[model samples]
Target chain A: MSDTKRPLSPHLQVYSWSLEMALSIFHRATGVALGGGALLITWWIIAIATGPDAYDQFRTVMSSITGKVFLFAFTFSLMLHMCNGIRHLFWDMGKGFDLGDSRRSSKMVLFFSVFLTALSWVIGYGMILEV
Target chain B: MSLRSPLGKVRGLGSAKNGTHHWWMQKVSAVALVPLTIWFVSSIVQMTRADYEVVINWMNSPIVAVLMLLFVTTGIYHLKLGLQVIIEDYIHSEGSKVFLQMLVTFSCVAVGTTAGFSILKIAL
Candidate 1:
């Protein structure tokens, strides 16, 4: 690569961080994280098909503390992505583009993501306890 | 104003007719996913204690199978489109950006196809 001077567009670093900016960045980050989680879904399916031993091993690993931590992270990322993805959908429909709407929607996405993730885990843990 | 040629009227740099399509599909998939993902998460939650046969039987149900397939396919498609925009905006190198886009597309198709086939086989 040659060292050449060229005009570059302003990026995130140039702007002071705000909730909207952070949400915009997190949206991409969560999208990539969710993509990795999608691959885990495929892995789960393959392990299931491979028989009891492999399935048990997979379960054991996934039930470990590290696995649980990763799962929680994945769950949070999924919730964040889903919430912001809906916000993006509204933007596509020509709504929620104003300054107030953008700010409010950004907060809503963050709030809902946390609430939904916690709710999902609570329900999940409740089921496990019942079993 | 000088007499302008017809080509001048049509010449401007924009999406070149492709802008709205990507935006629209992303929204369409997002809407579709609301119900699909809710069902998916709930099914998985319910299946927590399920054995292999139980899980397989659930997967074999026509409605579950169909919805899962739709979810996987549309999710991957939406992911590909979203990643393409991210890469285009962030990656300064045009060649690298294009390569990444192709890679994202290939991976999405590969993973989606594998999941689709596995779902079909289990259902069958």
Candidate 2:
């Protein structure tokens, strides 16, 4: 009885996905994730203010494998959000609204997000390890 | 032909009074955060290998302190605005929506204040 295939509203499942759509959703997801990252940073600041011992403890935890992984993900999320946020600002100004430009900008956002995250991590590790 | 005044007609259906202000602040903060975030990430990377005292010394600089204050303030403001929009979009229940929005606001304020205080405590 449930197998009847009458016309129904075009929900997310019914529609084909595009890069633009995925990036738009990702922008919001990254924004939400950044809130948690902000809290983590705030905790770091507080630890620093507490004392050397507290700061060392904080650094120890954050330098661990799991914490490093989370930090890397947070870096990528921030990069994506930052890149797409600029794209959004351009759109707000009535620029890059054309189909071609919009798609191109979305591709650029993804590319830069990955590129910047990698660059940042490389620089970060290079400084930390003096490599 | 309607007897109601304009205000009466749109009393419940009218736009929220601060919609434009909210939208404008979000955009303004987004613009400000672009440079601030870049500076922050670069600074953090530079300090990645520094010890606690060295990090504290960096924070003690006047320029660093001021920028950190600005970055945390603007970052928290943007986070609150963005989170509010997400909650409004996804949370259909009016009760939970209001609750979540208030929670986001309070948390952002608390985080911002704590960060600002720490920065001040170290920088000054």
Candidate 3:
């Protein structure tokens, strides 16, 4: 059906960068990243089911520096996706379609993503360090 | 030369049949995850310092087990849908798109089943 040499839509390079565009792209990017994160969770669950030895081995890796960094990134990605997802949900409801409202909401998404990511990490590290 | 009715010609094609299902499910799963994601994250954080026994026991709880199952199942379903959309958007090659889509669909099922089974094993 697409075999016709019809003119294609404008490509990314054609448009100037904007906050909403960035958020739109970031939503997909983080979504792909979280797909990988799902594997990590799957591994963790499998490890736990396999027994204590497997669980400890999994813990060793997760507690390592590299693991910590990935975990941190995963947390941020999750928060960002979750926040932007809510925006998309609002869009689905046919609200927040105004240009100004969309831009304003984009900023709120970024802010909350960062804030929630930080809050979770602080709580996470505090608990880890205490024990 | 076409004898078929206009509606009949378009029937069973494109979004004519269950076309919005994919789009709708993505939104539905997203809404479910709003609360599930928050709850799961907070629960994981609380157990950051927990030992294997503590974690296992937590998973064994009926409530925790049920939620964990829902989280994994819905999450993988959402992932599958999102990744399929991305693939369809960027991967223009028909063969490559189909291959990737199949890969993603199979992977999601495998991951979901594995995670679900593990949860049940511990809880039961």
In order, the B-chain TM-scores come to: 0.87, 0.87, 0.87
Strongest candidate by lDDT: 3
TM-score of each: 0.84, 0.89, 0.90
Top DockQ prediction, candidate number: 3
lDDT of 2 by residue, A25-112 (tens): 9999999899989998898889888889999898888899988988899999999999999999999999999999999999999999
Candidate 2 ranges beyond 4 A from true positions: A1-9, A127-130, B1-13
Alpha-carbon runs more than 4 Å astray in model 3: A1-9, A127-131, B1-16
User: Global lDDT of each model?
Assistant: 0.81, 0.90, 0.92
lDDT of 1 by residue, B5-123 (tens): 65654453233645467767877888988888777777786665567778777777899889888988888887888888889788999789889988999999999999888888777
Report how far off residue B95 is in candidate 3 (Å).
2.0
lDDT of 3 by residue, B37-103 (tens): 9999999988887899999999989999999999999999999999998998899999999999999
Compose the digit string of candidate 1's lDDT tens values, residues A1-131.
25657876687588888999889889889888889888878777766656667767777787898977877888899889989888887886799999999999998999999988887777776634554
Better of 2 and 3 by TM-score: 3
Task: Please give the ranking of all candidate structures by DockQ, highest first, separated by commas.
Answer: 3, 2, 1
Order of models, best TM-score first: 3, 2, 1
